[model samples]
Target chain A: MTEKKTLKRFASVFLASSLIVGALAGCSSSEEGTTTTTSGGSSSGSSDSSEVIKIGANLELSGAVASYGSSIGKGAELAVEEINAAGGIDGKQIELVKVDNKSENSEATNAAIKLATQDKVTAMIAPATSGNVIATAQIANQYKIPTVTASGTAPNVTENEDGSINDYVFRTCFIDPFQGIVAANFATELGAKNVAIYADNSSDYAKGLAASFKQQIEANGGKVVAEEAYVAKDVDFKSTLTNLKSKNPEFIFIPGYYEEVGLIVKQARELGIDVPLMGADGWDSPTLVELAGKDALNNTFITNHYSSQDPEETIQGFVKAFEGKFNESPNAFHALGYDTVYFIADAIKRAGSTDGEAIQKALAETTDLSLITGTFSVDEKHNPVKSATVLEYVDGNQKFNSKVNP
Target chain B: MEWLQQLVNGISLGSIYALIALGYTMVYGIIKLINFAHGDVFMLGAFIGFYAIARWDIGFIPALIISMLLCAIIGVIIERVAYKRLRNATRIAALITAIGVSLLIEYTVIFFRGASPEAYPEVMANKSISIFGASISSQSIMILAVTIVLMILLQFIVHKTKIGKAMRAVSHDADAARLMGINVDNTISATFAIGSALAGAAGVIFGIYYTRIDPLMGVLPGLKAFVAAVLGGIGSIPGAMVGGLVLGVVETIVSAIGYSLWRDAAAFVILILILILKPSGIFGKNAREKV
Candidate 1:
């Protein structure tokens, strides 16, 4: 009887210790996870507004669109550095609270929530991609946080489906319709009568760009000979390219990201369809040239936000600074990132406060803002009324062709 | 003419499926476990080839050989570490372990190499040869030739060699074969090594053909190859080859007819229909469940 009582006492003690260990482990692991999530940003838990103003950067640091996210992050970093060096927005240094969305839409929303609630950020800079920005913008709106995107150019990003403006959502880049019209005008100028479009059906950005480009092409009196669609992450385009070859269109328009576009170009060329390929800002990555051989890029063109070859003084200065810092040429996404930071800072300066409502009003009233891309102002729908640059790749070099104004 | 062109495209794609299917079939024939991680092994093969070409600057043939050899070792290690322990466990246990290994390898690769798709460098001069108004690239021809050669070699090893006979004996009955002095464990390891080597070759060919490699690249191809293995009769060698070709052609023709969205769905639909119609598969033999 004494031995049994001792055994029961031992069992209870063991259970209590196990529970304590489990709780300790859970606490440490949760802490570790939060630390990793908040590691991308500089300041953490600075809710007391006096020391520094916390601005959240929700970007895609890893996944399919990681290249865009990384570049945009670097550009934002450069802008933050320059701003802080120049006595940061009314004597309060801006502290960027960055979070990687892992190139996922759902994660973007989560990142936004964490930034708004957990980090207590004053304003948030959203992701570059339209799909991700659209996903997170709703959360930002619900939280009444002024959210600005660097390059989410889809029309519905700043506007609702019923054509209502999103009060908290704003962008530093032009919309898809403007980019599509620019591409169509460029193609028409090249004397193309009929064109084929190979679009990514799964992506909102691709479908949006393709639809607008088609509308603009027909409006310009040019016929769309063949239209083909493929989902993202599809590596094989031989069958579709083969079918397109028989149609023998004058040119091909691929409005998708660089990863798919590069493979499509290579496959199209291999199939002996030698028509020039055109795309939108999605083809601004260096991987495009690497994937599609340098020789294959001779006749390719893209409607970009900024060309690294631009000789404008403001653009040149940004380019030189970006190259010196990142040791790589800045693409359109980089310019947009730089512009997004400066735009947000300008709004804060005008508002004279870091309050969400104040920033939103100041952002809506933004005018005559000179950015790396172009001098522009935020329109009624919170999209920039800026010009798009047409970049032509000749012999592997991306040369600035011309600018198209909205 | 369009049909003919799609047919060529199908053959090219089918050959890759076939190469991958051989590994699945052979591994399943020896062990009842569905080696779900076989696809990731193929993915590793592609990465090995990528490093071979980009980092080592080696020729295509040498890279192919190196990848195959390295994958064979990897397969053996995976079998020894993960499968060997579960050999006597329930079928469900082994199957679940396979899935776990698959996830482990995929995420491990993602952790080491970022999830972005890397461009596979052009290792060979690309030249297309037109036949009857349909174009076939030299890369396609090379893939087909290599698959055929590997299949022939596999057949020889399984049918004629001592190890092959021992493998067949072990597959018939592991305990009985061990009683008869055959090293069942060694035979199982050999089967895994051979199967993994074939997967490695398929990876290199796929990378060369697609010119894109990512951590998740093996998922779809692996599932399709599993379907191919099922369509051809899971335990049959010749069945896998024929099934892969048919699947490739059907997918190509479906896409050619402007139903590209249904391309992935078609493979699963075929799987369901085959399961409903011929559960034993085209080449699968109907056998009673042992007590």
Candidate 2:
């Protein structure tokens, strides 16, 4: 009877400790949520009487694509710092409220809701990835906040599949179809008659880019020798590479992210299949070089947004400032981040008020706004009509090859 | 030539699966419990090998040794702490505990090192030697040789040694063996140590061959290895090796024939077919239960 009582007491104590832990976790997360709300509310509450404008930055600060998120966040923060240092936009200091999406689509939607309903941001800068932007764009539209994505390049990101424009969704990056056309044209320029595509079937970004490239390549009188697909998170590609090698295409296009691309390149080279590799913007991470080995990347090319090696003064200035602040050279995503913040601020300034409707109008009417990458206008679909830069890997360095204009 | 190339590819992949499957078969041979956390130990082994090479600048052989020793110790500790208490409990309870321990290790590793995949630094020069117009890398040859040597060593230990006799005796009837002056717990710990050591060696080899490692790298391969164990009658040593090789060859052939998406599905299909045709597996003897 005594032992039974002790067992019951132990069970109760265990339950109590777990409940305490659960409560503590809940409290900490709620404290973070409320801090953002209170801070945003206090700043914007005085916006009508004062010179402060609140903007929300929903980014993937820590997750699968955290490198892209953190780089883009740093770029946006740098732009904000520059704008404030120049005595603010129209004498109104821009207050940037940053929220991490944790690199998940569900978390991104939650971030949009929190920023819109609780923080009451007049406008928002969505996450860099296309999938995350699509996830949160509905929330932005529902909340009636003007939102801009710096690097969401999927075609459907700004336009619905039903041929209707998403007014609240805007991007500073070129769509995947344009990038794919650029790649096909570039492959033709290289005098490649036949090409192979090893696309990541699991990613919408990779599949869209591959489809576009294939269509354009055939239109430009080039034959797609073989097409193979692999799901995301697969490291082994020997069987697929071996099958593709039998076709013996002149160039292999892998429209996948750095993680899989790196392994694919390494395995392909190991199989003694030594043809130049090409990819889309997904191959623009530092981790690629470390994984694929510098020697393996010597004959590779990727279509990118901005090359840091650009001799243009505007690009140079941004690169220098970014390197100074981050202690590392900025990639294409960083440039998009910097350009995105300035783009949003430009709209806010042109709108002449912090009202969401006014900002949305100004964003739609943005024209020839010069920033990093190139000077272009936002079209009716809300995507930038900018040039795509083709970057070549020469002796382990990414050099600027050529720029293709839309 | 294409068939030859596919065969080489299959063998290279199959050897790694065999190395991991050996651990599962040996542990199940002794203890009735399936050690589900064994695969995570393989992942940990790879990380240990990676750190030994990247941080300490240790050579490949020394790194392999370090990973093997550490994982063996970890295997013994896991058995002592998690499995020992639940030894006499219901089979379902022990199985649940094994799964719980698997998640605990996977999440703890993820908590420390984020979920990003890391590149295994190239420690050896990768050179391929062509045989009958099929290029085979030196890495594949090394992996196959190591796997063969380890299997032979394991067979010798299990068949020839006095400890091997004690293990077999304890596996047959633990309480009876204990009554006849045998240490059942020590024999079981020795089995785990040897099995985990083989898994560690397999992990290091896999890292070298694939050139990438991540926290969750072991999940699919682990499941495949489990299937291999089951296909090879679960507790038989040679059966695990044959089953692994066959699974690897079938997967490679499927992918080579333009069914890359069905590679994983092909493994399970073979498993189901084998279970239906020969329930005792390829090398397993059909023994009637004395209930």
Candidate 3:
């Protein structure tokens, strides 16, 4: 009985010590969390009288499209830091009220609500993808705030299916149909009359590109010999490639992300289908070269926001600044994101006030505003009328081919 | 000719499904537990092989052997830690725990290696061999050969070894086998080791075949392999092989006819049709409910 008592006492002592350590660990972690949130942005207490211009960034920071969202976030942060450092727009510091949408539509809506209603942000930068941007567009409009999407290329992001232009929804990049048209024109320029389209069935971005490419290619007197669709996460595209090979198209347009496109290119090449392949901004990832290999991606092209390799003075200067800030060269998404923030700041500076209505008018009237991606004016549909650079993948490197202007 | 090409593609893909199905079938046959984590084991195996080939620069055979051995050990540990105590409990409890383990493994992988996919280097020379107007890559042929060799080796161990005899006994009647001095726990662990080892091999070949490896890659393939095991008459050895081939061919054929959008749905459609038409499966014995 005496031994059992000793054992019970020891167990209680151990439990007490462990509980104390657990509490201490929890406290430190919470403190670290607070530090990160504070360092990242003023995620809390952005009231109207805060003497700072609150820019709501509803982005995909940690989900399926996290890479795009986080890249844009970094660019936006850098742009804000530069603007604040250069003496804030109209002498008021820009408080970026960043929020994560988890790459989900409903979460994006919730983020917009939290930013608009609680944080009371004046202008908002939308999600990177089209669907997430569309999901939050209605909320932004309801709040009378103009939102700029960095890379949401779908037409429906700025316009509804019924051909109604979203009054307050604006984007800093060209639409999906524009990318498809550029590829089609590029194909025609190469004198390829026979073309095939293998597009992703999962995303509106790919489907939109496919539809526009088909429309423009048929207009250019090229016949679409074979049209096929593949879902996301599919690895084996051999059977489809074999079927497509029989049709004998001279060029193939694949409007999809890097993940599936890379494997498709490799597999198609292995099957002796050596036609030139093309994709859009979705294929602008280093993962593409890794997956498709240098040889397989030899004859591919993609229409992008801007090429960092461009010798344009504005572009080179922007690239240098971005590389210095982020320790890496800026991709098309980063350029678009950086340009998006500058786009808003330019509008706010012209509007001469933090008022949403004034900023909306100034943004809609944005004309020939030179930014990192390009000098662009907002069209009636809120799409940026800018030049897209066609990048050819030669020896696994994206070589700037030519710039196409709409 | 195009049909022939599709058939080649189907067979190669089917062989992978067969390998993964073997694990599910064997684990269920021996323990009467649906090891949902079996698919995640396959994913882990691919990642292991990716590290083996990509990081360590190990040759194909050594990488294959190393991946199989490591996965076998992981399989045994999963069974010991998660499933062993629940062996006497309800089957539902063990199945849920298996699913939990599967999610844990996938997320743990995702936590370490970000969600981006890693491209597997071409370990084998990619050369096309045309037979009867149907072009087949040497990579596909190699994958088919490795799968066949593994299946044959699994057959040899299952039907010929002392451990194999012990497995058959315990699967038939665990209580009776335990009474006869058979170590049930060790036999079960061996079964997992063998099964997971095959899954590991499948993962490596899959990486070579598709050349893209990601953390969440196991979920869909796992569910499909389960469907394959069911179609093959769950718990039946030979049934899993035939079932996997049939499923692969049907999926490819569906995509070949321009219904590519319905390709993934085609697998589940077959599953439903089989369950309704042949609930006992193609090779399953019609054992009545004991209750």
Candidate 4:
């Protein structure tokens, strides 16, 4: 009887724990100081000389883009380490209240809100995907907190229908239009007259790149043989490939991340299609070479923020420091991270205070800031106006090919 | 031209699904429990193949065999550890346990491989030959050929061998088969091992053809193969093949004809319509519960 009762109790406890974990998985931000308190009272800032500036870093730390996010986080951490080592920023140490969003939008949005309201973080560097950026930007704006995204490249991340950008949000990376134009011009320069496109229909970034690439290709007198669309999670591409081959294009342009790009390149090659391939910054991972093999990517080209082979002092310094720290060369996304922190630091120094309005004003007026990405200047609408680099893989390493000023 | 193109795409994909469904059907034949983990076993097979290439720089043929052997071992282990102990449990209990085992394998993959999909190396991907205005790659031809050979080998084994009789007997009635001096447990394990090996083969082809592999890669295909198994008649071997091919072809045709978004939805819609109207699939025997 005792054993039966004990077994029943154990089952109930296990069931409760599973339910709690499920709920946590669904709304993970609550554990990160996001509480369910009603919005009647707000706390006032205390006048402490050694004040703590809690900031949130929500990212996809364990998914397909983990390497990108992990490197970005390391870059950000490097900034924090440098700042703190130099006796902190404004005599207040910056504490990163980090949360792994794990690529789930609901959890990301929840984390952003939690960081803003419950943790009452002074600022945030958010949920990295373009969709996550758009979603979290609204919450940050609603709560009146300053948030800057490092690498959400979709135009809608900043721009509104009326050619205005969101006031509260800023991004370090160039918009998709810039990347698309750069890719298109690069393709034209390569003398490719016929091209096929495979795009991720779900992501705003992929759709934007496809539209822009197609428009530019047509504008440049290049024929689009076929356009195929795929969802983010679908790994199989036999049908898409077969359908695409019916048109018989000379080159293929995939404007998604490295995950599908690597697979597409490999499968496309296996099918005896040895056409050159082109992509955007999302293909700048070392894993791409490892996954797709160097030979497969021999003729591939892409437009990126900065390459590991960049000879610029800041970039070389960043590469060395990053390698010394993490033991691997940082990619374009990681460069965005290093630039994001520096950009924010520049704004803080200009603002001379952590006041949100002052920081926003300083950020809007950013100009001639030498970043690892390149020289960045914030436009009137607060988008980064900077030249990007064209990179190609040679002998298994991404090398700087040329700079495009689109 | 478009319709013809759609048909070609569908037939090609359907063949791949048919290969995977055979694994699901054969395992369920003996144990009556869906090997939910079978799809992951296929994924494991692909990874094993990848490892062979990465670590050993092995040629395609050797990589293929090593990958199949790895999957077989994984299947046998799953049987010994999870399914064997649950044989006496209620059917629903076994089904749920299978699901748990499947999730465990998937998450374990995520934990190690991370969430990002890895691209298959290009030795197989970047080659194509145009035939009849349809582009077919050497990889596709290889996938089709391997699947055909596997089907023939399976047919031969199931119809011509003593173990085949043991499998049939156990699947038909475990108690009667035991009375007739057949080792029911061993037959069931052998069935799972073979079924898992086929899944492994399909998985390697899937990874090569898709050019990407992730932890949760198996769920949709696994579910689809299960649906195929039922569509062909739950316990029928050839029926699973037919069902998988039909499902694959229909999905491909749907996408090729420009309803790309609705392509996946079409598979389930057809499965549901078929089940509601004709519970006994095209090749399935009408199952009657013994009172």
Candidate 5:
């Protein structure tokens, strides 16, 4: 009986200790929750009354798209550095609160709300995947947080059936339809008649590209001979390629990010299916050639926002600053991220305050603001009205194919 | 016609799953460990094959052999380092350690490979051909042929070899086998080495067939292969192959008939249904408690 009592006492003590530790850990976690600032200025304000400007970033910091997110973050950081250096936004340096959502939709939505309610961010910028933005837009709308997505091109992000954009949601990049049309037209102009479409069916980005390409192909009296789809994690495509072989396409149009597309191109080339592959802005990565190898990527064409080959002074200046800061040429996604910050900075300045409504209005009214992508003028749907450049992979290097001013 | 074509594709995919399941089942049969790192080893094989081809300019057959050898060696090392220490601990400890090992290997690969999907070298993947009323490529043929050959080889090794008898003895009664002067430790390591080698072969085929290799490539396929192992009766050799093939075919058919959006989630749903209906799996025998 005495031994039992002692054992019970020991059990209770252990349980109590665990409970205490757990409680302390939980409390510490809450205390250490992400630091969020308000006031469209940097946290390094010289005085308390200077009004803090909080710009929240919901990005994928880890996962397959992590490279894109990190690059975008670097670009955003660069822009903030420049803005702060140029006497700040109305004498207030912009403070960026970046939350890594890891590309999950629900996580991004929750992070958006956290930034909105807990952090009280004045505005938000998302260089997120399409699926994430689709989920986060509703939250942004609910909280009335004006958001600028750097590269989410899915039509669902900002559209209603009535042809109106969600008032609070805006994008700094061209929509998918715009990119798709440009790719299709470019393909047609190149005299490619029988084209194959390989897309990531789960992604709205890929789906939108496929649909637009098919429509444009049919319109131009060209045939979409084969359409194959894959998901994000799938590493095998033999069966899909085998099926595609029946169609005998002249060109392969793959509209997905570098991770899968590089492999697909390499695999297709290995399978003795040698045809020029075409893709969207998703192909604008140094890793593409590295992953797919120069031979496989040879003769491939893609539409992009900016080219590292751009000799224009404005573009060269941004590239120089980007390289000078980050020590690498900024890809198109990085440029969008950089341009997003500049766009937001311009909006904050035009609004004359960190008020959310004023910032949204200023963003909507943005016109003729020259960006690295091109001169930015927000369309009625809040997407950038800009031209796209065509790029070709030759000798394992991205060369400017042609410029399309649409 | 397209729907019919998709069904066939699903079955073919199922066959690949089955091949992977065999390795999972074989390892679990001997040690009752999940071998969570098996898929990554398979991925390593693919990368090894790639390196062999690109760096050494080895032909497909030679590269494949080299990949399997590397994978087998890694497997033996994993067993010696990770599994050997946990023999006296609780089963859960071993399971957790296995998970830790899996994560360690996966992250290590990711750190080195970066996050991008790499293109498989062209010599193996590019041949487009039509076979049996359906268009198939050279990659599909090679993958299918490799899986079949592995299955036959495994059957031969398991049913008709002295090592196979030793393996069976160890699985049935480890204490008795040790008492009978069997080299139990070496036998178990060999078992792991063989199973992991098979997984490596699967990985190379998958890489060539898919045409891309990425750091995160193994996670989903690994999970699905585990499910296939469980579905086919975890300890049964033939069962893993059958289970994998069935699961692959079911996923394909479901996506072809319904929407492709639910393709990934469908595998779990089927697994749940199967677990509910047949707790011991389709071919699993009641395991006698060792204690």
Candidate 6:
């Protein structure tokens, strides 16, 4: 029995040590793979002289953010389909090589490697969220590939904190500070003297918006009555909400994603804290209605890139094409995805070559290029100089409230 | 009054931990194995209830019954298939197997339903009843009531039924139970059934109260429930119940006092303190081990 126990201990220790060593080896190997392969601009993957203009789409197709990622994929697909049918980009058909990042930062890096090194695409579309886009930023620079994001609105997505811009990274939507200021201005217009800010502490997207909103709200002569935070994936908020209710603010700004935001809104209303709650583009999902009952969403507002209900001719035409293809009306994500493709295609057309360097140059020099979401020139920071629309939730549907321009 | 409101919130949440903790305590009593997969059983129960109400159009009560029954069967199957053969193995081996079973069930659910969360269909009217300056949603009241009634039923079943007698006998000594003509395997299976049935009921209440269900939702709650089991004394039922409620209230108080960030971490701290100060748990007797 003693000998058998010794054998068992030895076997278990051996197995445990092997697992630890295996994990460390795996991490180092992947790091080496990225470093070795993501090397030089001269080794930029695509040769645009072929019959196809290869465009890679690194998206979160099947994870926590699947609804946003898949919707953007559909809109991009629609734009590509129309372009292919109408004699392609300069008669060289655009072949989109789509990769699913699974809504993970690590997976986003892997997708960037697979797209930039192996797929040999001239340019690509980054993931929907800011963190995932940032994951691919360094890889984009390494490959000299110009990647445009549909809705990555964080300032760090395009420009680093040290005031150095990501030369190859671009975004179609307005930055986070713009949305925060826009929301503060809207609150001021609503005669809001005091406000509460409920932010998602885990996400840079929410934290960024919260900081800017606080600054602009105080600037607008409004006092911040309360500020609280809840991390993503938190399901209970009654205690926190009850505490906030005691502060008695007129407006509540919950800058978080739809998953937690929906529950917060529902729980807040249940506690009878009926002040008007506002958020940013993260609330632009149809599932928000299903999660937070229609009654709970009353008087809620969100600043978005575009609203399908906007009666502009450019917006209406894109909405019609989107609904006809998918059998459902498109949300702001879809519109942004569609515009991102056009934004890149316009750069490719003006550059007159599918070469990575040529397209990157054209993108940096983009001026007055118009799409369904907006018509604007790329600023020095590669952000769009354009307008944002605010929509109000009424009877479980988004009603276009007003447009704010910057 | 504000403090009272936080207490109400804590109890509703604690009842969930209590329901799940019972399964851990019962299984540990019978087999001396911490069934780590108990939390996933709760997750499965929520999904079962979700499909029954959302897809089959079943009423709330019937759907809850269906979820509980199905989860009970899943618990029994997990025991028979994964745990039965490991009964005589070393304790570490059995514990590792339990952890393996946990990951298997979580990934299997994720395989079928993608990682995106689903909102449970509204079961009850959205209404809050206020008392003594504290507002309690009807759903919270329902969760507390269901938990208490199920716990009472568990007590009665464990004390009154022949299987309950067999379970106590087996927990005392499996060899002695066999010598006394008790079917040890069947008694263990029944313990899993009853414990998992309560967890299933808790799952439905959790869905209705929180309104978001995901495949990996079971991980954190499972660890917390395990902590509750330990705090109550690993093999003591009454200890498990009291431990869960105390932990819940303490977490809520932490958040209410404006330290919401430490809410999740507070559970593990209590667990460590309990192990050092009173390893036998609150309701457990300091019985001497027979070598």
Best by lDDT: 3
Clashing pairs in 3: none
Candidate 1 residue runs with Cα over 4 Å from true position: A1-70, A80-124, A131-145, A345-359, B173-176
Best by DockQ: 3
- Candidate 1, A163: how far from true, in Å? 2.9
Better of 1 and 4 by TM-score: 1
**Over the stretch B204-264, how does candidate 1's per-residue lDDT look in tens digits?**
9999988888888999999999999999999888999998998998888778877887888
lDDT of 1 by residue, A67-142 (tens): 6787778888899889888878887888887898988999999999999999888899999888899898788888
DockQ winner, 1 or 6: 1
Model 5 CAPRI quality:
incorrect
Error of 5 at B12 (Å): 11
Tell me candidate 2's TM-score on chain B.
0.98
Candidate with the larger lDDT of 2 and 5:
2
Local accuracy by lDDT, each model: 0.85, 0.84, 0.87, 0.75, 0.77, 0.85
The CAPRI-style docking tier of model 4 reads: acceptable
Candidate ranking under lDDT, highest first, comes to 3, 6, 1, 2, 5, 4
TM-score of each: 0.87, 0.92, 0.89, 0.80, 0.71, 0.88
Error of 6 at A245 (Å): 1.0
Tens-digit lDDT track of model 2 for A1-406:
9999768855653453333223222322231111212122122324463567777889888767776777777788788889888878788777888888988999999999999988788889899888999999899888889999988888888889999988899998898888788889988988998999999999988999999999999999999999999998887788889999999899888999988998999889888888888998899877898888888888899999999998889899998999998898888888988898899999989999888889999999999999888888988888888898989887668989988888
Per-residue accuracy of model 3 over B54-129 as CA lDDT, tens digit each: 7778888898998899788888878876788788899899899888788777766655455678899878788888
Clashing pairs in 2: none
The best candidate in terms of TM-score: 2
Show model 3 residue runs off by greater than 4 Å. Answer: A1-54, A80-122, B286-291
Question: In order, what are the TM-scores of chain A for the candidates?
Answer: 0.84, 0.86, 0.87, 0.80, 0.82, 0.84
Q: What's the fnat for candidate 2, on a 0 to 1 scale?
A: 0.46
Model 6, span A5-115: residue lDDT tens: 768855654454333223222322231111111212111124554877878888878766776787788888888888878877887778777888989999999999999
Cα error, residue B235 of model 4, in Å, equals: 2.1
Q: For candidate 2, what is the DockQ?
A: 0.41
